[model samples]
Target: MRTTIRLLLKTYRFEFIAITLACLAMAGAELYLTSRLDALALPKECQFDQNISVEQGFATQPEEPVSDPTLVDSCQEKAIAFSDSDQRSAVLMSFGAALPVLAGILIGVAVVGRELETGTASLAWTLSRSRRRWYLTRALLVGAILGGVLLLPSFTANILEHARQPLIDPGSSFNDGGIRGPVLVMLGLLTYSIGVVTGAVVGRQLPAVIITLALALLAILAFENGVSRWESTLAEWQPAASSSYSIDIVLEQDYRDRASGLIVDQGSVFNAAPQVDGGPDGAWIDAHYDSVALVVPGSRYGDVVAVETGAIGAALLVLLGLGLFVVIHRRPD
Candidate 1:
């Protein structure tokens, strides 16, 4: 096993080093950016209070200053600065998130596609008695390495997310679903598996990378859509609290009739409002309707992650199986 690992490392030393360095850099950058964001403390008035009750929606909050009026300018300036820093962090984090996918594609295609493309696979196959064993050894080793390397960036991403929303629990929130935590590792592994299968079938690195990228994108889109639909199914009406500190995934936001417990359409309510003097008046709407939101709460984050990871794992198994079958039967040249 050590010999095989050494050989794999030696053969792809450049790619291995590049991916390792990139991951490390991403981790460092995330930490630095998170710290910068954290340094900007929000004033108590600017900070969201999540203790609001369902009956008194954010819209119904008393129109009185909670903090000294003098602090308003300072709060605005800090808020603006924080917002800018947060945007930068988001952009950097996006790149960091994509690093694993890029690494997986490069590593996976190089592992098998390059060998077959350059006709070295023929020699490797001749030396190995069993093609299945040969393929598994390389695939598993590379996959493990990729997963290990991805952890740093994933961990940093979690930290960054926590910094971004200090009030909300990162584990419970789905704010950056695919980019943080174990899900990122799972996504990396899934992409690697995809590249492996594509490489095995295409037998060419460039084309395999392209196809793998397309497949990965499609998989991501499908997975996100599927998860959203699943979440919608699990969604329940919750009091529409201000989302500044909330971790719920709101699907729909509308007013619910407090008395009848029925959803009221905003447009219809506005249209039906009696006009006083020369303008339509909505003064009575607030008394009859309560703002409610259909949402998947943060508590479901674990369940969603589990289901997503399991699906990806199953797909990885199937891809590995298909790749193995191809490698076992295909002519190395």
Candidate 2:
């Protein structure tokens, strides 16, 4: 196994180098953009009540009075700054999402598919190693190389998410949760597995690559949909003070059936204010007018990660089993 891996590495050393360099470039860009945004101080509206003062003179005061005309002009550009940062984040997130597909196609076609097409895989099976061991070693070597290559992008994604902490919806792609870090590497592994299996089964590079990509896409959609359902839960109510919540908080403002927990209707519940305090009338208004926000709090992020990791891991295991089955049953030709 070690000899096989070393020979494979010796042959593909340049290709691995190229992949590493590409990932580094991607990580560098992600870090640079996210770090710049992180360095920017939060605008006044976003920083509300971050540091409140109880003293008579300091209460409700802005963090600092802007006296310079230039500084005042810059202050007015907060919206622009936020927009730019959001755009950068969106770009990075899109790349992160597309990575598995790319991996599936590239690795599936280039590594196993191409070898099978040229009969090199058959030749390898004729050597000292058993077919099962040879296939397993190849799979492991490719998986390890791809996983290492993908680490930079994964780390960059995590860094970008943490740098812009609490700046996006909990259910949104921008939130790290399971879409970044080890989860992404696992996703890539799953994709790679699918690709290699497809290639080995088909013994045609282009067709195997295409099939691998399609399978990877379907798997990703299924995984994402499942994770979404797992991550969100019903909340009976939320506080009226929006300032108390971060942007990562996801709230569903739908009218639900009290008995069935089904959302029967949708509209704003907090439409009016109470006229007075401490009465049946005031209590009615408080109960009715105070909207019930079905919130998914940031505290549940860990749960999201755990559920997604389990789902992805299960998928990887299933793919591995299928791949092994194909290799084990095949006759040497």
Candidate 3:
């Protein structure tokens, strides 16, 4: 067992080291960027209590000027809803996570691929190693070594928003807790798994790499056309009105269930005053609040996010599983 482990580890040592170094370096860069951002002061609206006038003669005041630091600390953009840094981080991490897929595909093809193309795979299995052990060990080696290297960057990225994110009011994403880190790690492993599984099936390094790349293209198209098109959840918190149609939450499941011609206008929600204070009712909206509050009839925020989230993981699982199964069942001949 020790010999087999050592042999495999030796085979992948360099690749493992490279991945680890890359993860560490990238994570370090992210941390440094985060620190730099923290140092930069941003424009924040100070909501002082307007009630108590401070007389120059008296120190006693009716109300204290309270500062909600969270407001000041958050990153602001034009879009109020999705202006949080976490959402941007999640999107960036999603693309960043895909980077490992390319790396994994190349490495996966290299591990057993070069051996088979060079006629070393058959000889080694026939002379020294059990075929089943070889396949299983290689899979675990690719999975573990690569998975660990990929996991490190994401784990480190979370340190940025360590205690700032509260469940009661999920703050702008500064950490990896929500979707950024996990998505990156997941995409990396899935892509690498595809490459390894591809190699196992093709039994050649370079060809398997090519095949994996081709398959990745198909996955990309399907991911975009099918999963991402649903409900525009990608930019939900981004405060950007990228969607073609306005969203309405009705108790009914489909749009057909709502009143035929009755359009729900959410122009008010966006136009409404952002400040939370003891101002006159609807002071933000500027009038008799004729606009209705956008309601999600039966669904909730969790449901929307979950649907999009599931699409990402589910697509990865489908591709990785099918690729591995085919490779495992193929005959040695």
Give the top-scoring candidate (lDDT). 1
TM-score of each: 0.88, 0.75, 0.57
By lDDT: ranked, best first: 1, 2, 3
lDDT agreement with native, every candidate: 0.81, 0.63, 0.50
Per-residue error (Å), model 2, residue 295: 2.6
Provide the RMSD of all predictions against the true structure, rounded to 1 decimal.
3.2, 6.9, 10.9
Off by over 4 Å in 1: 48-66, 242-246, 271-281
Off by over 4 Å in 2: 42-73, 165-179, 233-237, 240-251, 254-289, 331-333
lDDT value, residue 179 of candidate 3: 36
Question: Over the stretch 1-333, how does candidate 2's per-residue lDDT look in tens digits?
Answer: 677778887766765666667678778878887777677765555532233322212254344666667766665585468557858886776777567557646774556666767877677777736776776777778778888888778878877775554345444432456557767777887788888788777778789878888888898888778766755652334432331234233445544344454543233222333334432354544444433355555556555566666777787667766777877776433
Q: What is the lDDT, from 0 to 100, of the residue 243 in candidate 2? A: 16
